[model samples]
Target: MARTATHSPARVDGPPAGPIEIDVRTRVFTWITDRVGVIAISRMSAEDLARARSRRLSHNVVTSRVFGPMPEDVSLTDLRIAGPDGPLTLRLYRPHGPLPAGRHPDEGLPVVVNFHGGGGSLGNLDQSDWLCAHVAARVGALVVSVDYRLAPEHPYPAARDDGYAALCWAVRHAEALGGRADRVAVMGDSAGGNLAAVVCLLAREAGPVIDAQVLLYPVVDLTFDAPSTTAFERGPMLTRADMDVFRTNYLGEGGDASDPFCSPLRAPDHRDLPPALVITAMVDPLHDDGVAYAERLRDAGVPTRHSDHARAVHGFICFPGVCRAAGEALAEICEELAARLA
Candidate 1:
């Protein structure tokens, strides 16, 4: 008989002020993230994220200040590996807290390779630290948050190439990273989700398919015709206008929006792709893209789960402490992956 052990539940403390109670935490983080909406590209170039860091310090304390409010205990490190084009940078976040040396439950664990959401810009592992910690602890997996090259400088296939390269690196070096290559999964939110989708597609086409993929509020389609696009066209975390700019810079001129690599929703076929866990935030503009992709997968005879987090917005998967929806979504993804891969 396979014996199963139970662990204590993870608890969140001191939420922010808001009428809406999101996931496990408060509205505090959202308030901060909203204020720091994408800074002008000019400002980012003029000054190297100094201004962004200042804002993060003011209200984004929990995420900005490392070692402060980190879930219980965790180990974090920055790693650089070679990608298809060039060097690939990533942040390896793992939960090794409290438990003594050899007592660590997941000493040798599987890895969830993640990509941060920012419409191909404006995000890093630091911004998604909370969710990374939660996944590492709850799923007992080493979470490698890939910091792929962003848009404008590196467009379309560049991001995809980098993401796939990172995937290859993770698999090849999983043993050294204390993870199992055979059990690797790819995950992302929003634009990052888009990358994850393409990564899976390309991986299947090229062989070495990943174990699974988890996409949250993903922008699977470059065309903006989804109902959620109009539903959340105005004031929200992610706006349609913002998406336009991201796509322009990400695809550049001469880019093919219909290319399955750029838009997995337009893939010729999804059959034989690894099982997927697709999540869409109700109020997100990209919600329909996720839905349409899931439906396509079903049509193509691929196992997929489509879920919508009602009353949520784009890229909520990483705002763990403040967005209960995000936490729940992450838990669902991890649970499903564990069952499938175990």
Candidate 2:
């Protein structure tokens, strides 16, 4: 088993309270996107939602620029695995380069299983190419990015089940994927972050030991009652109205928001989970969700680190080119994963 680090008191790092200061480049980027009406899923019709998903916004030229190109030192391959509902597509990332002297190709490398942020409805594997590839190269880990089933058509539990299934698959095939089975981590952003947290909780009671978790601007609570949800209700990127749409689409008619699997923040106990690095954006309505989750984990004696980026907006990490804080947060993520997985 990978060594578990000592529990650390949850400490938040960011600017003191004041008006939120979004980065200038971020301001300009949002202005252009808003003018173009890039994606307002809250206002989109069912047909429009289907069209948007088909477009795969995350792989477009503009998004490629914003999210940064896939690192040259990483190679990618797509494969299918059995998920709870059906077959699921997964993108595997491996670093380019020979093994270190005296080290076997399959030895010591860590594994990172990633889920992309799409509010349980919107994203795909292509959206996570940059982050997964970079982590593969930077941390010398095999990065498996899951293309989980979406909501409305699939609804509640579908995405979450796919997430846990992928994590189990990654661990089961770690050696074949050129990674150590014992050194594994789960990572995601936004709704994907919610999945990552839920996966860790599931693994704690079941099996497949996860060493670490990285949640970027995660939506841990579906209650939508966090103070930040009201404070930044009209987000520059992710608005409260948009969240309502996501909730309705993901939960469908009778889904429960308070379910521990749906809202990991509402879990009965947060103890015995993997260590975590929760990143939050000051301008995001889900900001308090990350803050509160980190506190819950820390209070439960789980090693946790909370980072609040003052100049970032919701999903800023996906727009690294425009968000300076994205790069800084990426460094923090890489460093944390490296240490925990090592």
lDDT values, one for every candidate = 0.70, 0.83
Q: What lDDT is reached at residue 40 by model 1? A: 34
* Model 2 regions more than 4 Å off: 1-18, 57-64, 98-108
* C-alpha RMSD values across all candidates: 7.9, 4.1
TM-score of each: 0.81, 0.92
TM-score of candidate 2 on Cα atoms, chains taken together: 0.92
Q: Which ranges in model 1 have alpha carbons more than 4 Å from their true place? A: 1-69, 97-107
Summarize candidate 1's per-residue lDDT along 220-325 as a digit string, tens digits.
8787776667766753567777778778878987987888888888888889887888887755677667777777776777777777676566666655445556
Model 2: per-residue lDDT, tens digit, 134-153?
A: 88887888899999999889
Clashes of 2: 0
- Candidate 2, run of 10 with poorest lDDT: 1-10
